[model samples]
Target: MTPFWKLSAAGFAATAIAYGPARMGFGLFLPEFRSVFSISLQAAGFISSLGFFGFFVGLLISQFLTARRGPRPPIVLGLAAATTGMSLVAVASNLTVLSLGVLLAMLSAGFSWTPFSDAINRQVEERLRPVSLSLVSTGTGLGIVAAGAAALLMSIGGVSWRLCWALFAVGSAFALLCNWIALSGAGEASGVRRPLRWQALFRRATTPIFAIGLCYGVTSTVYISFAADRIAQAGGVPGLPANLSGSLVFICYGAFGLLGLVTGQIKTLTGLPWLLRLLLLASALSSVLIALAPASWAGVVVSAGLQGINVMMTSAVLAFWSDRLFPAFPSRGFTAVLLAVATGSVLGPVAAGSFASHFGVTAMFLATAALAASAALAIRSGYISETPHPE
Candidate 1:
């Protein structure tokens, strides 16, 4: 593989590894945390939501910092913060400390992920960018699988969840070290320019992009937040032995990345909007399947896989759209999309959790399916049409 490919792969791996513990692993460890901290379920959920909140704040900060200093410093700083945060969580004994740790970890993750993506977008050739991005996204799946395996192993070894987090922290530190080495000589000096106001970009193509992004974000957030729990519940998998469920979720995500590659090629062959519609339909169908699945492991796995494909396809398609819409400002456009993702992440979990708390997991799945369906309609109606540049 070429140096760019190697860097992309390394970057992807770092992202996946860092987020595995912070995002997916946290849910797996939630029960154990509750026991240790003596917190209520609602409180625990609130704490997890705090991480997302921090992520939002971090993204905003990253935009300004990256604009001024370019992306490297924030990326490095974010990775360092995430490493420390995860370590703090591993040793945290109180709810306040744990919450703070999670917050910091998420903030670091957001900072690292966005700037790294910006760097990749800046450095890589245009045509190869999507493939490289899809490859990078595969890291998320890999990390989730690793987290699940770790959870299972820890359970089998009679180790505490805290210990698992500590181990994950050690791994994250190693990942951070590797990223530092790989990216050390890769930093760019910021070009001198007047900083553009956020509103300048926001007011231009902002409404439609954010509108579409909101729908996409909500769907993604809901799916990620509750997919594992739903699978475990549906499959009757024990909470402690969560390997199969976690692995299944990650596998689904990986499959989705593969699907993204395939679909991206198809978009090149056919058209992007058409491909997006297909993804939306798939996502909607996946949700319904999850909602109606029998209490069997196979049913859960199948649903998870479908959800994975749906999400990956949606992301890939939207990314293509962003590239087309904002050819001059890929990072800014992508960040706009991410802002929507963050919004969805915030709303999805809270909404799903509410539905789960009041009704059941199935209802949450159904609601998410509706959201996916609505987004498909929005795309079809040309709410996200590309504007023609002045002749």
Candidate 2:
């Protein structure tokens, strides 16, 4: 196998474990966590917020490590965090331990993503870099699919949630092993590392990228944290148990997320502006579908599917976009974009939880849909460049 293929495969597995079972799984299992821990929606939101905050911390650390050392250290460190964090979640007997585990696990996502930009730039041919990044981003959905399937089967078999988390830890460990082997003897950073230039980092040309990131963070976090709970409360689809229905939503999410591998092709055909508009619209529609028909199995499944596609595609777009915008500092610039996203993530759950307490989850989802729609309108209003910024 070629180096690009090897790195892509290992990167895919690393992202799958870090984002899927380790990071996103908390929301997937939120209902059960609530039941066991006897926490309220508000508390759950707080925990979710804490996890995103941890992601913010991880991103900062990752940028530093990736800039100074290389992609290997941060990537390996992230998988190790996934393995350890999920293990703690698996065996936690108290809410405090669970929260700590979740924070550590979510941190892996921050660590896991940005370094790949550096790796791709270092390892792959320039023309193939975007494709590799998109493929790696698609791993997020596959991981979700795997975790959701496991949860569904376990739910049916009456297995313990703890056991499910333990299995997740095992998967994380395997991902760690894959990355360790794949990244062996990887090249470290070369030359004198320059500090980030905030002026270049915060250009008017990049406004839309940061805006989209923030909006995506809010909307996606809200959906991931609450959509399943809302579906369960709506009694799920008829003829199926609520838990199964929820799991199926994520399955649809992960399965259709595979479609994001085509994002580079789509961007080539449609250009970045149109792609951003379309993705934002899909995100809006995903939330609107749930807001309008949470109880409809078809509605929820389609909603999850659209969200999965939008998320994966948008991530790929952001990866290449930032890489192009800051060719000299691919990982650093990408970290800035991710930090914006993480900031929104940090605020989304807590705010949504509070809003849901007042208006209702459906209402909160509608509000989120509106936010996404407004972002799409912003794109249509010439807020973004039709093509990528020059290197």
TM-score for each of the candidates: 0.85, 0.94
Q: Rate the local accuracy (lDDT) of all candidates.
A: 0.67, 0.86
lDDT of 1: 0.67
In lDDT terms, which candidate is top?
A: 2
lDDT of 2 at 183: 85
* RMSD vs true structure, all candidates: 3.4, 1.9
Give the top-scoring candidate (TM-score). 2
TM-score of 1: 0.85
For residue 265, model 1's alpha carbon misses the true position, in angstroms, by 1.2
Worst 10 residues of 2 by lDDT: 382-391
**Which parts of model 2 are misplaced by more than 4 Å?**
125-131, 386-391
How many pairs of residues in model 1 come into backbone collision? 0
For residues 1-391, write the lDDT of model 1, one tens digit per residue.
5546765866786777655666655665654665578755346456666777777777878877888777767776776777788888888978878988888877765676666666666677788776676667667666766776777676677877778878877877777777777666556745766455345456544466677677766676566555655555555444434434544555555444455557667877757566666677777777777678634566656666676677666666666677666666666667777777777666666666766678777777788888878777766435546663111
